[model samples]
Structure formats: structure tokens, C-alpha cells
Target: MKLKTSFIQLPLLFDAQRLLAEINALDASCWRDHPQKFPGNFALPLISVEGDPANDGVAGPMRPTPYLEHCPYLMQVLEKIGAVWGRSRLMKLSGHAEVKPHVDLNYYWRERVRVHVPVVTQPAVRFICGDEEVNMKAGECWLFDTWRMHRVINDAAAERIHLVADTVGSERFWNTVDRGRDPFAGSVTENWHPETFSGLASPSPPRLTYESVNFPDVMTPWELREHLLFLLDDTRPHEQLARVRQIASRFITVWQEIWAAHGDAPHAWPIYREKLDAFEQQIHRFAGELKFNSNMSFIEGMNGLIFIGALGDRRQPTATQGMRRAS
Candidate 1:
């Protein structure tokens, strides 16, 4: 009834070509349509199984098809982590979609574990749990404690595939079931304690700071415009919009500090005036968009506009007029 963390590596490398071919053969449109649960495009019914008892009763748990039975590599890896074969489920994920952060509601209080085998992936696929962010490569297997908050995102251009399995019963059951193999090997010793292992006291909630906000590296002015356009297009949650404004304000402050540092330079005054004017205009735009109240913390809103606007298209405008026209 407690949470635990452990580590295990698979015995074999995944066969990417075979997995891809199998994925291509299955029907994935349903998953794509209902992307909040299983994001992006993907194939399914690679196996036969009874439908979900909780939701799709009478059919039993869904099973993968016969062709994928050869992927015993995942089974072997789970065995190393003291997981049983029959108790697990199989899931596949594809590119540019994400399962938002959430805890496993069904089995968190029990001693179950979820294992993942990355059959194919790009570096942008990240599995995050609490403070840990893991990027799994092709053929790598990982056993994560989903009792705590966890989420997966595939931001890559290429697709990704994973075989998901869950283990039921106690750690003792797993140890006895496997026999002679040490499942706890290399696992964090503190994981056996639920209080420490469950991430209950991980830290203070993450502060939304200016530096924590991501900015595209080495972006040109035209690209910056496109970035802003993208932000405007997307439907942002209210909290995110507020964060964007806060971050923007901080950036303007930093810029002002730089200007102050170079006040003695011959061209510093004119450059500062120009930059300040443009930055102030951006602040006004973001403030207008967010309808920020006057009581909000000061940074002059310029940083926020810059942050939002920087998510623009990369191709430079043909001319300054073109840039003006796009905006």
C-alpha cells in the first residue's frame, strides 16, 4: 500500500523496423480523435484482448496481436524489476502529442509499477515525474513509480512508440515469482519508504520566473515576429498568459539594467531610447491582450510582449514593410 521507486534495463534492443511496420498496420484513428487520453496519430489492435473492465466491460483487457508476441524483450525487462506478465497492459504512443501530468488513480496506494519500453523515439520525447525528467531512447526500458505525478510528451518531428505494462501484487510476490534475480539492484534505497519515495515533500511548487520561461535561441527579428504570431494564435490558459506577462516585465528590467551599465558609451543613449520605445509598445500590446489590472507587479509589460512575440515563424520577412504588414 506504499509507493516505491526502482530501476531496470531491458535485456534486448528493440527492433525498430518490425515495430514500425506493425504500428502502421493497426487502426489508430480512434486514439488520434480522443487525443487527451492517447495523443497524436498511432495504430492500435496490434494485439487481441478483452476490453477494459472498468470502461469497456465484457471484452476483458485489450491484448496485443500475435506479431508483437515476439517482443518478449519488454517482458524480460519487467521480470528484472519483479513484475508479472499477465497483470500488465500494453499502450503505444506517437509523435507531437502528450499525456498531461497526472497520478495513476487505480494503483497508486498498491505496490504496482508501470514499465515502459521505448521501441522508437526522438530526443524530444520526455517522461517527467516530479523533479525528474527522463528522456528515453529507442530500445531502452524504464520502470517508473506512477503513484506520484507523471506525464509524457513527444515534441519531436518523428513518431515514438512505447510498450506499457503494469505489475500487480507485492514486492515479495515479485521477488518470489522471479526467483534468484535481484529486482532491487541499482534502485534507490530510499524508494522503499512511501513518505520519502512518494514525492510528498519534494519541494516548494515551482516558481514561474522569467528565466524559467523558454526563449528560442539565436532568433532573428523576423523569426521573433512569427513567434509572437504563434502565441497569439494559440488559445492560452489565463494563468499562462499571466506568467508570460510577468516574464516579459522581468526581461525589460534586465534590458534597462544593461542600458544603465553602458550609459557612458557614445551611442548608448540613442540605442537605449529606440529599444525602450519598441519594448514599451510590446508591453502595451500584451497588457491589452491580458487586460492586466493596474495593481499587477511592474516590469512595464515589455518583457511579456517579447516573450509572447518571440514564438514567431522563422523565415524572415522580405522587407521591414513586410514585417509591418504581417503584424
Candidate 2:
């Protein structure tokens, strides 16, 4: 999601050593290559679809994998964040590796904010977002704008690892974010103090909230309108902007009318699909060459957010056809 700044350091800290101990105890076989197979990038699932460690899909009910059930301190780390979690993992960047610069246009990411807790990292590992870059130290909590183009580079000889989690955020989480400081905001942390997790072992299991409904069977008209407005507002100036807006306005009007008539009933699926298909063709015709400020194509966002997910399954595109994985 977009933020007021490229990065926000939350007013919380964790026991990096204790977190690392839990990480170390885990078997090496659990780590998997990046879903896109970015060289030298790997991950170990903490939460995933149906609690299956091998599943990287963003849709379906999210649940904790066995990997999470055995780690007390990691659970404590998550609890302190105070948010309903989505797919999460321990992201590892091998020495000398880098995460290529890219913006996350996935529909799942359009609403969710990714949280980063640096469990193991070096000063030389720099996270670059837009015009700014920062070396997130171990145990520090942070959030970044996924909508902006960003990347990570590890110049150090040793590997770097971080606990990366996602959430739509909760009331408490937003409150915490309100208290957070942007790293570029000029010594904002001088007066602000942070709460630290001591990493004491838990006596019982931690009960955490997980997402049960992420994608929609048929998106509500209000939400679809909101997304359309957001995209139009974010589009960079282009010769086609005026015509695209006209098309979008007409499409939204038709969608709202259909929603009034059928309201996501199974019988309405065909109508919804037909309108969605028409909209897709119109959008691609006018806005295919247009791009967001983040350099992602506007059609990519439309496909990811509306075409594939707005009304249950349409035929899915190949990995190369739509938005690529952000992490």
C-alpha cells in the first residue's frame, strides 16, 4: 500500500538474538526458492494458504504452518504487532544478492501492508525505495510503501534474513502506525521511545487472527468504484487519459446497475463476467501503453485487481501475463 513516506519505523523492537535462535532451530529443508525463482532469494513459510508450507497462493483461508506452531518467540513477535496476519515468511537474501526494483501491483497487496522485523541483517544491507534508502537494523520494526518501486541489496558477505508479514491492518495497528516515524522526517525518533519484546518463552500457544476472506466472489460496486478512482487518480498524465476516464465512468455505471439488479447471486455471475470482459477489452485498448508513477503498466493493475478477481475465476493468465510477486 502507499504511505505518506517511503518508509515508517514503528515504535517497537524485538529480541533479535532470541528470534534468531528460533530461526536456527528450524530445519534447513524448509526453505524454498522464491516463487518467481529470483536468484539467491529464498523463504520459509510461517503462514500460508490452508497452513500448507508449500503453497504460495494469496487466495483462500490463511493459517499458521507447523513451522510457526513450534516457535514461541516468533509468535510473540507477531502478537506484539497487533494485527490480523496474512501470508508471511522468513525472507532470506544470500550474500551479494539483490531484490530487483519493482512495484507490487497484485490485488492482494493493494490493500495489505507488509511489516518487516529484521531478525538478522547487516549494516551493509540497504533497502532502497524511490529516492531514499535505509539499512534496517536487527530487531527493528518497519513498514514500507509496496506501491512504490523498491528493492533490497546485500553488500555484506554474510546472508541477511527478516520476518516479513502482511496485514490489512487493525484499529490498534493503525494507531501504532500513527505513532511511527518516517526515517526521512528529521530526527523524529529523538523524543519517541519504543517498547521492546524481551522474547521470554511462552507457557502456552499463541492464538492469532488469520484472514478467512481475502478475495471476493463478486466485488461490491462501491469497492470497484473506489479502485477505479484510485487508479485514475494515480495515472500519470497521458494523451489517452480523458478517453480512458470516459470508458471507466461508463463501465462503473454498468457495474453499479448490475450490482443493484443481482448483488452477487450465483445467477448473476454470467452478467458480471460479461461486463468485466467488456471493460477489460476497453481498458486495454485505451490504457495499455499508460503506466503508473511506479513504472508499472496500468493494465497490469486492472488485471490483477479486477479482471482475475472481481467475479470469481475467469481464466487465469500465465505468470508472465499479470503482476509479478512483490517479495
Instruction: Quote each prediction's TM-score.
Output: 0.41, 0.96
- Best model per lDDT: 2
Candidate 1 structure lDDT? 0.41
Q: Please tell me which predicted candidate would have the highest TM-score against the true structure.
A: 2
Q: Model 1 over residues 26-69: C-alpha lDDT tens digits?
A: 44442322212344633332222332212211112334344344
The residue-by-residue lDDT of candidate 2 on 181-261, one tens digit each, is: 888877756788778878656698677899988888889989998888888898999999999999989988999999999
Q: Can you tell me which runs of candidate 1 are displaced by over 4 Å?
A: 1-3, 6-14, 25-83, 86-90, 107-109, 169-327
Query: lDDT of each structure?
Result: 0.41, 0.88
Candidate 1's TM-score reads 0.41
